[model samples]
Target: MGCLENLNYEILAKNCSFKETRDIVKRMCKERYEIPPGFKIVGKGVVGIPPIHVGIREEKLVCTYTKPCHGTFVILVDSPEDIEQVRKNGKPVK
Candidate 1:
């Protein structure tokens, strides 16, 4: 999925990248609450937002399934503190 801004929570899913959202949906359809080893997918977000998929490997997310053509997967890895924490411990963002 993409990003969600100000909108009623009920209608947010209508705006996400369909393929990305669809893949995630399909995986969940096969089995509820499935996540990779040593990680967790959160069931909710701040305020009236939907569930979030955390602990995703940023490197792995930029693959052919999501892109389908030659392009870029822009990851804004801001914050030296956060980067350092991940580098040092491999801990997923909370």
Candidate 2:
């Protein structure tokens, strides 16, 4: 199953608030990309923000967003391979 689909959203929702979830996602991105968590890319102005939301589905964390200037952003991945799959499918990665 997909990472996001395997996530336990119920547990994540109960243990972490929306803000906390966003923070964790940002941190993960920061660590992965070696940049600041809120750094802007492709004119998005940040990896997580307004129109950009983060949440947990099943037992995985999910990040999605839409930007007036950059179009849309939707990424659902658990590992680097999944990320590559999403990109190969022409979807955003975050």
Candidate 3:
């Protein structure tokens, strides 16, 4: 499997809908990385399932409007390694 670093967020934004992006990320994490069972489409691809249903700003992939996850939590991305640093922002993991 390829690394999440190779993902092209801009291309994914142009090619897929938000739901598609979310599904792809979840599936890839499960199949390729052995990380599964915990993922949701929060605002701005927020991961760890924040309680608030506050949808994030849908501005391309790396939406500036999306706020950080509640209290240092992480947003979902392509790679497990960068979940805390920089999320895939807007892109599919596959």
Candidate 4:
């Protein structure tokens, strides 16, 4: 796994829209990454589900807005090993 300090990344604004996040990923992430269809950063939450979601998709870090009232955001991880850090804190998508 690559060290966190070794990975180049930025935590996008919480107000960033899902579309904006996707666009950023496409433009920034240089690896084969996927943001699942219907992926939402902020929306109606399930009782047991978290309002904020974080995970790794295709080696890239993907996350939702931190609060229900906020919008989505993005974190650009530089290595596939970075996936481990995400999984430690959240679940993985299919």
Best model per lDDT = 4
> Per-candidate TM vs. native?
0.21, 0.27, 0.24, 0.40
Q: lDDT (CA) for every model shown?
A: 0.27, 0.38, 0.29, 0.44
Ordered from best to worst TM-score, the candidate numbers read 4, 2, 3, 1
Q: What is the lDDT, from 0 to 100, of the residue 43 in candidate 4?
A: 29
**Clashes in predicted model 1:** 0
After TM-score superposition, what is the CA distance of residue 60 in candidate 4 from its true location, in Å? Answer: 7.3
Task: Sort all candidates by lDDT, best to worst.
Answer: 4, 2, 3, 1
Per-residue lDDT of candidate 3, residues 1-94 (tens digit) = 1332354333223334334444444432432221122333322233333221211223212211122432222123333333322233323233
Reference-based lDDT, residue 14, model 3: 30
Expressed as tens digits, the lDDT of each residue in 5-85 for candidate 4 is: 455655755577666654554454443233333432222221112233444445666443333566554654445543554
Pairs clashing within candidate 4: none
Model 2 misplacement above 4 A? 1-14, 31-50, 53-94
Model 3, runs deviating above 4 Å = 1-14, 31-81, 86-94
